[model samples]
Target: DQQVKQNSPSLSVQEGRISILNCDYTNSMFDYFLWYKKYPAEGPTFLISISSIKDKNEDGRFTVFLNKSAKHLSLHIVPSQPGDSAVYFCAASPNNNDMRFGAGTRLTVKP
Candidate 1:
């Protein structure tokens, strides 16, 4: 069974709008959650992250929220731009070394 899941396969948003991506996890032992953005051929790049101890973590236009009790997490992009269009993957790890990733959510930001 997959430990991390992204129910939405894709999302579309207008430029300069907000984009929200949802993710869920089955493993409660995961103490760290991360969001990664991937381009066509490039490797996934780290976006934002949240620890089990914190409910929210933000970095400029990217923000990550985690609900430990619910085993749920989300990534929010404010003022989305066309350049932000990419595949987003949610990841979880207990020791920050061994990680499990969601399928991926393709985000299209229309200009």
Candidate 2:
């Protein structure tokens, strides 16, 4: 069964604006949340990720927030650039052995 879901299949934003991607999971056992950005024909590249230990994590222009109680997570990209346009995936894992992925949300940044 699909435990992860990205309600919005796509998002559009202008350059210099912030982009927020949201994901929801039904599994409470998930302790790890990861965000990945995928370019056409290339494998998804790791973006921002967070563990249950922290409610939020920040890396450069990327940040991830987790609400354990709500079983929800969100990835935020500040001042999004055209290069940031890609398919983004949200993944949850209890451990490395089993990870679940949301279908993915395609983000388009227009200049």
Candidate 3:
């Protein structure tokens, strides 16, 4: 069974708007959650992250929210741009090297 899941396969948003991506985990032991953005023909790059101890973490236009009790996490991007179009993956780890990743959500920011 997959430990991490992204129910939405894709999302579309207008440029300069907001885009939200969601992820869920089945493992309660996961302590660290991370979001990565991947462009075509390139590797996934780190975006934002949240620790289990905190409910929310933000970095500029990117924000990550975690709900431990619900085993859910989400990433929000404000003022979405066409450059932000990419595949977003949610990854979780039990504070170790073993990380599990969601399938990924393709976000298309239309101009």
Candidate 4:
């Protein structure tokens, strides 16, 4: 059974604006949160992540926030850029190894 779900299948943002991507999980045992960005024919690249113990994690223009109580997570990108355009996947793991990925949300950042 799939444990993770991406609420929105796609999102579009104007350049220099903020983009928010959301996901929800059925398993409460999820301890780690991760977001990945993928191009057409490339493997997914790690974007941002967080632990269930923390509410948020940030790296440059990307941030992943986990709301454990609601079993929800969100990835925020500030000043979204065209290069940031890609398919974004939300993933969660119980022990850092057994991870599950949700159907990705394609983000388009228009200049």
What do the candidate models score in CA lDDT, each in turn? 0.96, 0.94, 0.96, 0.93
Clashing residue pairs in candidate 1 (N, C-alpha, C atoms within 3 angstroms): none
- Candidate 4, residue 79: lDDT: 82
Model 4 misplaced regions, further than 4 Å: none
What does candidate 2's lDDT look like per residue over 8-100, in tens digits? 999999999999999999998999999999999999998878999999999999999999999999999998999999999999999955888
What's model 2's TM-score?
0.97
List the candidates ranked by lDDT, beginning with the highest: 3, 1, 2, 4
Report the number of the highest-lDDT candidate. 3
Put down candidate 1 lDDT per residue, 1-111, tens digits, no spaces: 999999999999999999999999999889999999999989999988898999999999999988888899999999999999999999999998999999999999999
Write candidate 3's Cα lDDT for 1-96 as tens digits.
989999999999999999999999999999999999999999999998888999999999999999999999999999899999999999999975
In candidate 2, how many Å is residue 25 off? 0.3
lDDT of 4 by residue, 7-98 (tens): 78999999999999999999988899899999999999988889888998889988888888899999999989999999999999999998
All candidates: TM-score: 0.98, 0.97, 0.98, 0.97
**Superior candidate under lDDT, 1 versus 4:** 1
Q: Which model, 2 or 3, shows the larger lDDT?
A: 3
List the pairs of residues colliding in candidate 2.
none
